[model samples]
Every structure is written in C-alpha cells, then in structure tokens.
Target chain A: MSDKSITRRDFLVKTAQGASLAVTGGLLWAYLVRQEAKAQPYALRPPGALAEMDFNAACIKCGQCVNACPPDILKLAPAGANLPIGTPYFEPRTGACIMCPDIPCLIACPTGALAPELKDINKARMGLAVIDIENCLSWKGLRCEVCHRDCPLKGKAITLETDPRGLSKHAVFRPMVNSDYCTGCGICEKACPTEVAAIRILPPALVQGKIGDHYRLGWTFDTEITQDFKPSEQAPPAPETSGGKPAGMDYLNDGGGL
Target chain B: MNTPADLSHSKLVSRPLGARLWSWRYVVLRRLSQFGILLLFFGTAHWAWEWPAKTPLLTGNLSASELFGRIPMADPFAVLQIFLSGHVLQQKVILGAAIVLGFYLLVGGRVFCAWACPVNMVTDLAGWLRARLPIPAMFVVSRNIRYFVLAASLVLSALTGLAAFEWVSPVGMMHREIIFGLGAGAMALTAIFLFDLLILKNGWCGHLCPLGGFWSLVGRTALVRVRFDKTTCTHCGECARVCPEPQVLNLKRLEETGFVTSGECSNCGRCSPLCPEGSLAFDLRPLIRKHGAEGSISSVRRTK
Candidate 1:
C-alpha cells in the first residue's frame, strides 16, 4: 500500500489491468460452459424458455417459475451444480412438466426468459421425445403402447407407425414422435414401461441432426422445371470406384424396365 | 492510555448483555428482519404442515416473490440484469422492480444490505467474531472496487447474455443453499465467510459485491441520511471506530458538509448509538449537496 496519492497514470493502469483480467476470466468461463451449453443433460427448462443460448442471457435466475409450478417439479440449479446456477430445470424421470392449462410458470417469469407469447403449453419445445428402437418393447415384437397412450398431445404428437417389413404375425405398433407436434413435454418418457424408459426426451440441440448442404436430394428438384431433365438415350458413364457398371447396373436395361 | 472515546466504548461493550441489547435497538430490528425473512422462506420450502396443506402464505424464493397472487416483489439487481441482457422487459417485472426501487429510494438503498440480505447477517456475524478474536488486519481493499465490480458484472451480462454474477452470487447461494442444504455451493459461502473473518474485514460486501454497489447508487438520492450536529460534538472519534465505512464520517468532510453524504453508508446506525455526545442522528432532508461528489462544499443546513 503506497502512501502517495494515486496519480492519473496509476488509475489508468489499474483500470486497464482489471478490465483485461475480467475479459479473460469471462471468456474462459464462457468457453468452459460451452460444452455444457450444447448438452443440457436431460435438464428440462420451463415452457417457452428461449433456446439454450438466449435463455441463458434472458434468465435472471429469479426462481419465480419454480414457485409458480404447482407440481414442485421446477428447481433452480445449485451454484456450480450443472446447467448454469439459478436457472430452473426439471428431471423428467423425477416429475415431468404437467403442461398446466394456464401455464403459470410463463406468467410468473418476469424476464421474457420464458416466452410470454407462449400461452399454449402444447407449443412448448423443451426437448424432443425419441423412442429407442433397439430397446423399445414394441420394436422388439411385444405389444407396448404405454408411451403412445400417455402422450399429452396423444394422436398428434405420438402415433403408431407400422413396420414396412411385415415380419410380425400380429400388427407392429412402433411409437414415433412427430417433431412438428411433439412439444417434448416428456409425458411419454415418464409413462414408458421399460426398465430403462424406451422413449426419452432429448434437448433439441442433441436430437436435430443435420445433413451437409452439398448432398442435395435429387428428387426434391421438379423434373418438369429443370432444363437438364432430358431423358438420355445413351449409356450412363462407368462407376468411379468399380471402373465399370457390371452386375449392379445396366442403365439402358434399368431404364427400360422402369 | 485509552482516550475518553475508548473509555465510553469499553463501558458500552462491558455492559450486561441485556443492557447492551437494549442500547442497540436498530441492530436488533435489522437482525430480526433478516432472520425473519429467511425463516419464512425456509418454512415455505421445508416445513409446511401436510394435513393443513392449504396454499402457503409466502411461496417465492430469494430472487423474487408474489404474495397472495397479487403483490409482486422482485430483486432490483436481478431484474436489471435481465433488462441489460436485451430481454424484453415485461410489464409485471418492470412494475415489480419499480416498486422495489421506489422503496429503497425512500429508506435509502443500502438498507437492503443491512435489513434484508441474508448474506449480510453472515458477514455481520463474521465482523462480530473478528472483533472478539485476536485477528490481524491482513490487507486493504479500496471501497471503489465495488463500483468496478458492478461495472464488470454489467459488462459481462451484456457480453455473455446471462445474469453473469447470479451464477456465483453468494447472497443467492446462501439463500438457496441454506434451504436446500448447500450441496455444491457450500464452498463459495464458506470462502466468503472466511474472507470476511480472516483476510479483509467486510471484504465481500464492503469491497466486492456488485449488488451492494448497485444499491449504494440508488442510496445516493435517498431521502434518509445521517446528519452530524457539529456544535454539540466532542472530537471523541467513537463514531469512526464502529463505523463500517469510516471514510464516510471523515472529520474534515463532516466539518465541510454537515451530513454524511456518501451513499455507501448502510444507515446501520452503528455510529449514532456509539457516539458519546449524541451528535449523529438519522434525518430526512433534501440532498442538495453530496460532499463525496463535490469536494469541500459548505453545509446546506444552518451551521451551529
């Protein structure tokens, strides 16, 4: 501690030092939490919470939503406990969001952390429910419609899709989630009768897979509109890997059969 | 060898527990307010009667509350973070924050730190224990650091798109963890206590907490302030001894301006009761001139 008064230079230096230190610390913190941000670890946010990035910014960690929840399902993440401290999350395995008619939690959120416009709880996209085909009893040739039965949106969100293979003696009812209708309420996940629940709600970030933009689906382009849609009379080129089209394809014969 | 101020202070300290408790009236009130608020939260969370499991009276947590589904109470700092982070400020949140801000404007802002914040009780306990223990002052922290801390948190919130400090705020941590049994946040609370007890006395609240700093800004224009009656004063210096922010009660500053104008004052009334000459009093007056803001200004009130 210096006895001399702080010169203008001293103040400037300290400010610069402090600012730099803080910036570095903040960036480091954001980076450390980036992985956690990507995967919410089955932590279900209250209805209408913006996507993970926006919600983190918007939520003040007020815990008002937790109080508003009648089922006592909502709980704020403890400091240094996963999913960013003070942000509310629920484990579906414990107790799922009941999709209350009035949606009390959204009304309770002071910050638009929970989207105020989301008056309909059915529209909540907390996560996407995906049925594990390998572990699902219905997929294993057993009659298990537990998930499909308990879905809040029922017919719209979770519907039975029959197997095209037609190997079963009886009808195969495989529960499939329609992403458009599934609110990711986790009701189906909660209701699954399997030892390890077959249907699980996964955060949107994890479940939504992307295909490379370069790999265009050829059929998507209208054949009527494309100038290059000339029906070729000549033989097709040899395959690049195999050097020639031998057993698999004789383009002329295939075209004639089609 | 002790001065007359020390003699009176020692006498006050030496008095029986009952007499001393009566003497410190405001302290008792503040403690009761802090502890009472905490108990309400604890009871609502953990101890409601099952049979009479009617709607709980107080249902909210530390960051915000709604009483009887009508009254909306919020922590101004927490709400402000949301706004600063580019969140749409809903009408209810705005009104709730305004109500809190308005209350602080009347009573003085640092009143929250003294009367409501559970963390203050912990730090105050640490301060009390430090007084009795033979602890040596380890270092000095400039109180201006709080303003910097406030600035940094605001910047971080804007940049990171989060209520940045709420992630680690010991105040929120203690409130939540105290009820939930401090699973992971125990270390943070323990560190704060130890920091106050051993390192810099009043380190966290006095020098570091951005929330306290924010309230101090709100406290600047507050109507209630400490007024020094210079005419009746002996230069006993007892007011400075117990004062949390001793710089607020600087003799030269008081002589120049009759009121302690720094919003940093918690209005804890620790100085007033400790004053041997009864020169210090909490008064309601217009803050025409804040001595801390403009240096060496003459007293606005009539000088004795």
Candidate 2:
C-alpha cells in the first residue's frame, strides 16, 4: 500500500471538498426546508419564557426543564416530531404545567430562554384558554363547571357566568375566561371532561386579538365638546301651520300660533 | 505447533486480562465509565418512574448533569449553543463547561466520543456484528466529512436560530430514549445505527457526527496522545485493521514523527493493545514541547 501523507496540497484539497459539501448542504436546507415549512403554533413554553421568537432562538435544547418538572409534563421536542426539536413543550390535554411556586423550569434553564426575572409564575402567558361554547356541556344546559373549578387562578382567571339565554328555572352556568388574570397554564384546558375539550389552550399568538388602530368610540373622543351644541342649520323647517286649525283655536286670538 | 515453553510465553503476552492488564487499562476504564455514566442517568429514570413523586436519585439527563448534589457538568456543544444564541449565559453553565473542557484538554477531547457518547457504544456493537456477519461496507466517506457536518450544523443553527443538531443528535437521542422513553428518539437511534452499520463503516462517529468532529478539533493539541515507536515495529499492520479512524494511522508518518499527530485520532489505545510488538503506547506531553525531535524520541523510549 502507498504511504499516503497529508501534504499541504492534500489539506487544501480536503478543505475545498469540505467547503463544497457545506455550501451544498446549506443550499439544500434553504431550498427544501424553508420552502415547505409551515408555521407551528407556538408550544406551551415553561414559565418565564421569552416571547416565542426569542425563546426559539435562546433555548439550547437541553432537557433541564423536563427533568425539573415535578409533574413531568414538560418534554423536549423529539427529532422529526411535529414540533421543532429539542425545545421544551407540553400538550395541555395530555398534561399541563402545574405552575410550580418557585418555577423550577426557569431556574433550571442555563440560558435565559426562560427568564429568571419571571419570579411570579402567575405572570406567565403560555397560551390563552378559549372555551368552545358550542361544544361546552354547560352551554348545552347540563351543569359543568370543571374548567372554572380546575383553573389555577380559580375565580380570577375563570369564572362561571350564568347563561343569559337560559330559562330562569334552569340557568346554564357558562365558564368565562378572563384574559387579564389567566396565565394560560392550561390546567383548565387539561381538566375539561369533554372528549374534545370545551376549553383548549391556544398559543398567545393565535388567541390574542390585534386591536384596530382606526376604531375610536365617539364618546371617548374630545371632538364632542369642540362641535356646536346647537341644532344644525340644516334642521327641517317647522311644518307649515296646519290648514285646518280648530275653530276654537282660531278664536283664541291674536298674538301667535301655538 | 509450538513447544510448551513457546505456548506459555505466547499465553503470557496474550493473556487478554492477566499479565497485560496495563495494556488494556484505559480501555477498561473507558468501558467502566461509559457503563457507569449510562447507569447513573437511567437509574434515576427507573427510580423516578417507580416513585413518580420522590426520586432518591439526582435529577438530570445526559445533555447536562448535576451529579452528587450540585456538581454540574455540561456538554461543550450545548454550551456552544448557548453562547451563539444570544441568550444570557448563566455562571453555572460557563463553570460547568470550563470544568468539562479542562478535563478533555488534559486527557483527550475525543475521549468523550470513545467513553461517554452512548451512540458510540451502540455503533461499536453494530460494527462488531457487521464484522462477524456477511456484510459489506456500502461506501467509503472521507473522515473530513464530519468537519463539514460540524460547519453546516452551525450554519443551520444560525439560519434557524436554535441548536439544530441537538434536536436530532443520535447521541442525545439514545440517551433520551433510555431515560425519557421517547419513541421518536428510539427511532432516530435505530436509524443512525443502521446507517453506520450498513451504509459506511463507522459512518456516524467518523464521518457524520458534528459533536465528534468538534471534539477532534478541540483535541488537536491534547496532552495525552498515542506514541508510536519505529524501532520496535514489525510492520504487522494489525493496528490499522482494528482502528476506527484508520486514516489517522500512517506508517510512514509514524516512522517520521514517532507519534500519531492526527487531530482525528481518538487516543482510544486500540492500536497499543493490538500491536503484536508492543510498539505503540499512550504518553503524556506538554503542549509547547510537542513535535521536537528529541522530545518525540524520548517519549517513544519512555513508552518502551
């Protein structure tokens, strides 16, 4: 066999080969992967996570969060799984974030993907729990308050409001989600008893509505005061005096038309 | 066909575990560590499953471990991800990475490939089975492909904004499969094994694994290395046959430099134990003095 040595020439040749491979691989990823990619609704992130984009960029894909989860709801996305791989996520219906007091997942994070400043777990907005009123047992008039009962924030985040349309004798108590206090922990979503849960966690991106900039209620505007308070000049002229005034009115006299 | 004295002398040298214990000492140590590390991760998993609430064992996975009540150790690649991602790098993480990096620099970086990576052990089993079976390597890939893979993975990470390889890495996958029982991780590990066993010999570790490639780069100036003695060598060629990265072994180069200077060399000590003439051995060197004419010569003699 020839005694092959890695000369400088060979090193350059290998480097060229490696560079070519890298270029081709990168191009392939750009063309094939980016072209066909679909946006996955953001998974339920651990408490203290940055915004979706920041979290995706910051997370190192270590399973520290999964290990720290006492209830074991957190799982690192597996390779080729529906979600992007290695980031921590949990399916609400399968299991929900238990909202640990210390927020152990945040503490366990080596990167600030889950920010340490998120000392209050209640501040976490992982996703919004939107109730499908049509499918809700309570909406169908069977008395179910599972979501309101199971909510981590209890009465603040979720409250049972009597269905206004229900008969007085048989009031349907519908569970309403108050976005202000809801942390989106998904406990209510997970605890829903329906085959298809009436309350489901929707990623913040999906459920949070964008306010239209153009909308301003007339009462809220200061323009009301600036405008003339008097009746407009264009107001219709007073109807001509009726041709048939009563005879008694004609006699009454003088000075004016009533 | 040999006489009783010849048989005894041959048996003494090739005792496998008795007289030549030191020859295989590192290999034994590596195996013990590999198995022990695996057990440490899996034992907690098993205990966690049985108890579900109060596990007696420590909490961690293979990617990052906090063993013995807060002695943190992290994967360097994982740390690299944190550094590149613009995240707030925690003090504990940097300390852990430094500790691990220091260990590999002092020993050899590729020691992780040979001793700690669970995927390496699985591939070894597959390679062993293939050697015994009527299997032929489908193709040969340049060992340098891993460097390209490493580069491309980093590029992809930059584009995608995450540590992309960690998601699919068979090393982390196999570990997860064992501890977390992820079905997808199991599938990924199986696919890697099949690709390594059937597609190319040592394909994953030698040609495709970015982590191993990164470590090889880190190990370029490693203190611990395989020393080759030219005077005692009979040119038997057994070492090359057993070597996982045979490209690192150039007989003429060994004759010239008296040591394996290839960064790709794992310093696994396979060649040392298999060298019929005991011409190769492990040696420690200071970084600054490496490759001096007198230095190499003295190290070779010391090994003898």
Candidate 3:
C-alpha cells in the first residue's frame, strides 16, 4: 500500500509542481493562440466577412461558407498553411470569387463571421486590386486593359485614363481602380495576362492609405473645411515708439529678440 | 484469480470464427459509425451528392454542418466556447447546437467521442498496438487532469475572446482536414498516436482532451448505461483490461449502483461483449434499478 500521510515538505513540493505545470502549460497555450491569431492579415476572406479581429473571434471554422460557394473558390486553411487554421480563404491566381449574385456564402455562415447585413454582393470589399505599374502591359504603352474590361463593375470599379505619348499620336489607356466601387473580387487579378499577375488583390488594410482629417483639398467641389484660418480685419494698435525708435525696433537694438 | 491472458487464450481457442467475430460486434459497429460519418461528409462536399430536392446531402464538417441544405447540426462544445468568447451566434447554428446537445443528453454525451470522433480511430489503433507491443509507460498523470483542462479551456475562451481550444484542437484539425483536404493537421494525429502508443496508454482521450472531458460531464444523466449483475460476475478481470477507463468498472461501486454510474464511461461497448460470465450488458438507466431489485429477491429465494 502507498503511504497515505503527507509531510509539510511533500505538500509544498506537490503544490509547487502542480502550480508550475499549470503555469507553464497555460503560457505555452496562450503563446500558440497569440501566434495563430496574428496570422489573419495574409488571408483574403469571403464576401461579407467580418473585420479581421471580429472574424477571428467569430469564425467557428466550419467551412459552411466554403461549401456554399458556387465557384468552389474558398478553402479552409489547413494546419501548417500559415493562415488561421480551418478559416476559409481563397487564392485569386488559381480561383477568384465569382461574386455570386445570390450571395450564398454569406447566407451560409452560421456564426455571423460573414455579416448578414450585407445584402448585395457588389458591396463586398474582399481586397483591393493593386497594380505593379512597371510590369503592367498597359503602363508599358500597350493596349492591354484586361482588368478594366473584365471587372464586374467595369466602368465604375476600374476606369481607363488615356495618357497621350509625347511627339506621337499613340496614347496609353491606363487602368485605375476606384476604391468606392471595387469589390476586390479578384477577377481583375485573374484576368491579368502577365506571366506573374501584374494586378493582384491585397487586403485593403495593407494597400490603402488614409489622408487624415487635418489636410483637406480646398479645390475640390465639396470640401468640408470646418474653420479656415484668417487674419484679423483690424490690426492691433502699434507698440509705442521708444526713444523715437521704429515700432518693434527696441527689442532688436536691446539684443532681446535673439 | 483469472487474469486477462488466461481469459483471452482459453476463451478464443474454443470459440469458432463466427463466435470470435460476434465478440467483436460492437467494435465493428463503432468503426462503421466512425467511417460512415466521414464518408457522408466527404461525398457531399466533393462529389456533389445531393437529395432529390437538389440540396447537398451534407455541407460543412464536424465543427458544424447542415443536412440536405436545411437542418443545421453543430458541435455543442465548440459553440459553447464561441459563446463564452462573447460571440452571439446566428440562430441557425445555435439551433443546430441545441439539436445535437439534446440528442447526446438523451443517449450519452461521450457517444460523440466513441461513435463520431475521427481521432478515436487513430488513438484506438495506437492503444491496440501498445497493448501487444510491450511498450512501458513513460509516466503517469491523474485522469482528473482532463477536467482541469476543460475548465481552463472555458476560462481561456472568456479571457482571449476567441474559441481558445477550437483554434488549436487536434480533434477539429483531423476531422476538418480529412473532409476538406489534408495538411499539417496529420502531424497532430501522428503526435497523439505516438503519445498514446509510447508515452502513455489512452493518454489523449482519457487524460488530456477537454472535448472528451466536456462530454464526460454531460454523460452523467444519460439514459443508456452498462448494467452490472453482481451474482453472475466471475471477477475474471477481462473487461477492466480492455476498458479504456477501467476505474468505471470498480465492482463495489457497480454492486451498489447496479450500473456504471460514472460519467466517464463512454458507452463504447467494449466491456459488455467481452464479459465472460455474461454479467455486464447495456440497459436503460430506469430499468437498471428494477432489475437490481429483482436480482436481489431471486438471490434471497435461492439461498432459502
């Protein structure tokens, strides 16, 4: 039979062992969770997906959305994929979201990871399509504007700007992405003919920049400049001349202004 | 005085092949249940197998799924953790979880662990190999450790604002990966297999899995249970040896309760068919008490 009695030393040692194991195990688990949570930025979610933080917390990683997708573009990130494990993501180069009119994937989400508030597929900003100007055929003075032509919202999301060549009649029809309407469905990226896609979709947070509220374009038609700086209409009374010196000259002569 | 070795060799040599196979009926049934669930999920996802109504037969995996594109079914433990993490789930998934929870509450909670969990197959294989391979245990830990793990998972979910265990669960990883596609998730299963086979016996399921721990707690009031007949028992030690959780077979407790009372009994049906004297069998919890009373009266009459 084992000894039933415990010495004070034994009790202390046992308590310390249990505490240490719990602490060590807890810390290791927390570290793993932190690492997994940090991996969400690289993944592109389905249409109507919640913001990165909310989506991470909300997604049950069920792949119901993946199943509901008609084009079969979405995949649950498997372990060691470097994306949050089991969360649905898609690769645009291989298969991009077709932007299904019915929004089956959004309806399929059980956990509200894909927000139900999104009624229209056109509003989905899955990512922003960024152009590598140097590698782009259109930017190289060719007539290639496949992204502009193939965009679901062709005229609104992707618009062509004609730049005339110097000393020649040839003009480059450069494709520009308008953030207001671009859904980031990645059809443009898929349609890019370059060996490596010149136009690629990226999470908007990675590529989009904000001009803070401090700076406003006054020339714009509807500039919301709250208060414009103005000089006082009436100038304050001039300082009294000291020893017949010019106003504001006494400080200069006294070497106080420096 | 009869050990597991004597019972196995003596009993098996005399039995015909049909009788031998009959002994393994529950084991075979468990395998069928495990594989059949996986096949359904796989076929629906990949092959576009659908009902006559054109609804996919099953969508999603074990974490959550829908049957025939209408009835939702979800993992209750996972849903609970998500709720604890402060997510208000959609009605569809919450309903799904309720349906599954209600079913398990009636049958037995760990029935999910034995009948549905894919990880059980891998660990069962490890256990079978370990029993025959002469691998000594590396160390021993309290089985109660799983309860602590389960509590910790809940606390962690509340603290982290994420379904803490689901993020790292090997059970979820294995099931989701198999139905969808394979990935480094297999590594988790391999680690568990080696851990069960070499480091300890039934290490993952019995000692560490919080999901199993959750189900064990839920299984306490389950209707189905293993009924024990004390008069017929030979105490041959066959059932305990094969049992994943042998402590549940404590004869003194069984005698008093007239049934396995522990929530930890997974209703895996391993011990019932293997009982040499036909002492143990599955019965309804309500019927067990009546059977126990009748058994005592019959024994008293025999003595007189």
User: Against the true structure, whose lDDT is highest?
Assistant: 3
DockQ of 1: 0.41
Task: Estimate, for each residue in A1-258, the C-alpha lDDT of model 3 and write its tens digit.
Answer: 246566767889999998898878887887788789877686899999888877988899888888888999999999988898889999998899999988999998988999999999999989999999999999888889999999999999999988877226688889998999989899999999999999999999999899998888876757765346455799987779777655666668787657
lDDT of 1 at B124: 86
**Candidate 2 lDDT, tens digit per residue, B1-304?**
3854344335435555553666567678778888888777777645553233443244456567665546667787776764665556667667777888888887788988898888887788777777777878677667887887787767776676556566456787677666665757777677778887788888888888999998998888788888776766656566787788887889899887667877788887777765655667777765323544444344333222
lDDT of 2 by residue, A42-119 (tens): 578888888877777666665677777889888876656666556788889989988989898888776677888888
Clashing pairs in 3: none
TM for every model, in the order presented, reads: 0.82, 0.79, 0.90
Say which prediction, candidate 2 or candidate 3, comes out ahead on TM-score: 3
- The local distance difference test score of model 1 is 0.76
> Against the true structure, whose TM-score is highest?
3
Runs off by more than 4 Å, candidate 3: A1-12, A166-169, A221-258, B1-13, B296-304
- Between candidates 1 and 2, which one is better according to lDDT? 1
The order of the candidates by lDDT, greatest first, is: 3, 1, 2
Compute the interface RMSD for each candidate structure: 2.7, 3.1, 0.9
The per-prediction CA RMSD against the true structure, in angstroms, equals: 6.5, 7.6, 5.5
- The residue-by-residue lDDT of candidate 3 on B1-304, one tens digit each, is 2675466446645766666678799889999999999999998889888985689888898899999888999999999999998988899999999989888887888888888999999999999999999898899889999998998888888888888899999999998998889999999999999999999899999899999999999999999998898886657777898999999999999988899988888899998877665678888899988977777333322110
Better of 2 and 3 by lDDT: 3
Worst 10 residues of 2 chain A by lDDT: A30-39
Q: Give fnat (model 2).
A: 0.46
